[model samples]
Target: MQERPPFKTLFAVPLHCEGCISSVTNALSQVEGILSVECHLEHQLVEVEGTAAPSKISKSLQDIGKDCILRGSGNANSAAVCILETHAPNVENPVRGLARLVQAGPEFTIFDISLKGLQPGIYQASIRQNGDISNGAASTGGVWEEDTRGTEARGRLGQIEVDSEGSGGIILDISVAIWELIGRSMVLSPGTELFRQDDEATLVGVIARSAGIWENDKVVCSCSGKTVWEERVEQTGKGML
Candidate 1:
């Protein structure tokens, strides 16, 4: 397997003093696949460059009692995100998973995905041809085709095995471009089959552009009048892991 190149990910952390910086750096340094760690006490930001999943980094910080939020990732115009949701009427909270895609190089992209509130079983993920989720994954069309050669579906992102607690995640290096996936839809369907349609347990979300490093600096949301941490609480309350 080809080694994945390192990419930068910035996070807004609560840094009060130099000790905080040292602690954050130490925690991240211990994480596997992390190449470098830089903490800015003045800006209260932590910048990590490596092949580590952002979620893993965040969890490490959280384990040390530090609250951190991902501010940006990748390079300009090279990052995207998706919120995988189930549109089944019987399901109260539709959200079931999340996906983050960042272009690590000219020939490949890094895909970090997480799932929660799902049954303990195997599931498959894929990028569909359309962005529509009107009928959940059923409306998203087929898996994205790389070309007309009828070759393998480059958008098939592979399997995720949920634990008994209904959570699972993975970081993958795939041969696809961030630009090619914009405006598409990502589906997480229960089973090992790659082309299964939407079911009650299926989760779907649209691919949307996400901020790159230093691109988003707002600490407060303009529409909600809530700080970033406050927004995080709200999202957490909504079952976003």
Candidate 2:
């Protein structure tokens, strides 16, 4: 197989709005080989991808009066990366829970996560993998993705599996938190390693266990924002309506 291209992610200063994205974009445009820049408004996270050097990226941003946090570094082909944010009111309660998600998939693939299921002050993160697992860490963002000081960690979850088959299956019932208001979802990183009968199962449906992706088929029901990762991926695979 062809080797995957190396990719690095970093967190820039807390941006207040799209204007901030424009600000960083305008400032960083002075650099070269910046393949793409995704500034998530919901997560308050800025992902810059390209041939640009991390140090240079840092220097330029710093010169422009912005700080950056490198989330992770790996080849995009091999590493699927996603971030979990839990910004509950009494956010402290969910800190440890969110950290667990980061530990679950250190070399996490950027899968679709939403926060609709999350309560105002409760937070958790879930990661799905199907091969050798890796450790991960948290930058300075909230567990459910918000502007605040948070923790970073690194470890491994068993692997990514959305469902199970014969012998291997989920070890425990996992919790999913979401917010209908913002169209965000958080897959709770397991408190311990989980097992599934199959490896190809999508994390959303399988991880939810016999009950399915949601307790009662409840999903982040929103028509405004983009369809979530699960819906989009499924629709694409099935050629949906």
Candidate 3:
């Protein structure tokens, strides 16, 4: 049998001196399944080559007082890209942006979102139950919906601030199980928004889906893709139409 290649992960650290470099390198080396640890002091980055669980490696570094940011990893592969769309198609001007989700660790995912051509202000972000980007549609429900407008905020993603140039960026650290969010969509409301009870008033839309769902190397939803509703039926044996 051919030997599998070792996993590699690059992390950004705060190494200021040789001692700090030595400490980080030694600590990572001690972790089980770690084949090698290389520190680049000039860049304050450490590269670990091994088969260790990413979460375990991060915890080991934290144990030694080394705070690290994951730059990239062999184990970190699942991700999705989304193009933000406006809810109202007839509106003369619309919000435009892109968002990406990447698996950061075993229990956490990172959401990197950027927006342009938006009104400069604060907006509320949340994950909704539908990946529908259409002007009007009904959702086949399989996920939790804590209604923020009427009852409570179920999947609150906090607020994002658009700057003077109508551009904004935010990185979200979500602790929810990533698999649960696979088929949902992200929605951004206009203004310093409160939980909106009306669906027609939403400003932006982007489907949150697995990176694997694509056609001809392009990600799209045109009634020809594997849908969240299908997954729900398979899991629960309940046909969703």
Q: Give the winner by TM-score.
A: 1
- lDDT winner, 1 or 2: 1
> Residue-wise lDDT of candidate 2 within 18-90, one digit each (tens)?
7888988877777775777777766556677654545455557778777554444333222222323233233
Superior candidate under lDDT, 1 versus 3: 1
Model 1 earns a TM-score of: 0.95
Instruction: Rank candidates by TM-score, best first.
Output: 1, 3, 2
- Against the true structure, what is each candidate's TM-score? 0.95, 0.30, 0.49
Q: What TM-score should be assigned to candidate 3?
A: 0.49
lDDT of 1 at 140: 88
lDDT rank, highest first?
Answer: 1, 3, 2
Q: Which ten residues in a row have the lowest lDDT in candidate 2?
A: 95-104
Model 3, runs deviating above 4 Å: 1-77, 90-95, 136-154, 194-201, 208-241
Residue pairs whose backbone atoms clash in candidate 1 = none
RMSD of each: 1.5, 17.7, 14.3
Model 1 per-residue lDDT tens digits across residues 1-241? 6678889999999999988998999999999999999998888899999989899899999999999989899899999999988887877777888898889888688889999889999988888899988988888888888454344778777889999999999888898889999999998888778655666689899999999999989988999999999999999888776
Candidate 2 lDDT (Cα, whole model)? 0.35
